[model samples]
Target: MSINDIIAEKRKNVEEIETKIAQLNRKLSFSTLSEEKKKIMEEITKLEKQKRESEYELQKLQNERLNELAEQLRKRREQEKQEERLSTVLPPVEEFTLRVCFKCTEKTNCEAFLTKNRQKMLPCILSELLNH
Candidate 1:
């Protein structure tokens, strides 16, 4: 089962244990015999321990879920930052075409013009062309 399902089940178990303990306490109050009261008290003790264990497990699961969500949020933020950096480094499509592609005589079949790093080199190349 999923963590959420497990957590819900544990919570339910804790609640049921609490209810049982309450019922046993009510029964203990009405019991006239010493043996019957001792037996009821023992059962209540066991149920209370079980309730404590269930509550601890529920708290652990909730913390784990929170950590998972925090990790996902961190990764998404990093990806968005990387995309923003790329967008700032590269000129807009229209400006790149006008500044570099239109001015270059070898528009087609030019290795430097068609290479992946052309965007990085475009500014330097354009500056050299302007100087000449």
Candidate 2:
């Protein structure tokens, strides 16, 4: 059951105990009064104990749910931080460098093109990757 439902049930039990105690107090007389009072007190104690147990269980369940949500939030934040770090600190493709032929496409030397146009092509390649 939900925490609120458990708490409401606990409150109901307490109210019942209080009603019983009040009734017992009203019915108290000289004959057998002590025995009846003791019995009613015992019943109240048991009900109170049950109420405490229910409250404890409710708290435990709430804490478990809170912890699970907290863990999920923490993991999501950590993942976002890792992504941010990667985006800011690392290039899109580490194994490849930007090399484009400015003169002609046929029989172009990629290494010669990269060495000559590295400064100009770097920003264009990074922007394309970012947009993609």
Candidate 3:
């Protein structure tokens, strides 16, 4: 996915988390209740804490993504300089490479890595090659 796509996805996730936090708070606002209220309060607190942590992570990712874009622009300018100096250079897009997360396949059974989308299964490589 593009960087914009990633940022959009993160924003959506943040919004979902915020909605959950709000829902938890609304649930917590009930005054008249049995011991269940206390249990609900505890769960709300946990959810709020988790939301805070996730917000922090989202902020970190936003900053990192901005920095990565700046660095990429800088590298592109540097490459232009090298091309001017050397008279031979590759384009920025050609320089990029993707490395698969083998561990992600093993652990989560990542659907994206699979050759064929299955109702239930990891990539074929995980079962066939990795023998797991």
Predicted structure with the largest TM-score when compared to the true one: 1
Q: What is the C-alpha RMSD of each candidate to the true structure, in Å?
A: 4.7, 9.7, 22.7
Q: Which residue pairs show backbone clashes in model 2?
A: none
| Global lDDT scores for all candidate models | 0.80, 0.61, 0.62
Clashes of each: 0, 0, 0
Better model by TM-score, 1 or 3? 1
lDDT of 3 at 114: 46
Please give the RMSD of candidate 3 to the true structure. 22.7
In angstroms, give how far residue 7 of model 3 lies from its true place: 3.4
TM-score per prediction, in order, is 0.69, 0.47, 0.49
Among these predicted structures, which one has the highest lDDT?
1
Clashes of 2: 0
Better of 2 and 3 by lDDT: 3
lDDT of 1 by residue, 37-125 (tens): 99998999998888888899999999998998999999999999998998887766556654565456665444555673576557656
For candidate 2, write residues 4-100 as lDDT tens digits: 6765665676567667656655655433767877876676577567657766765676677688789999999999999999877755543334322
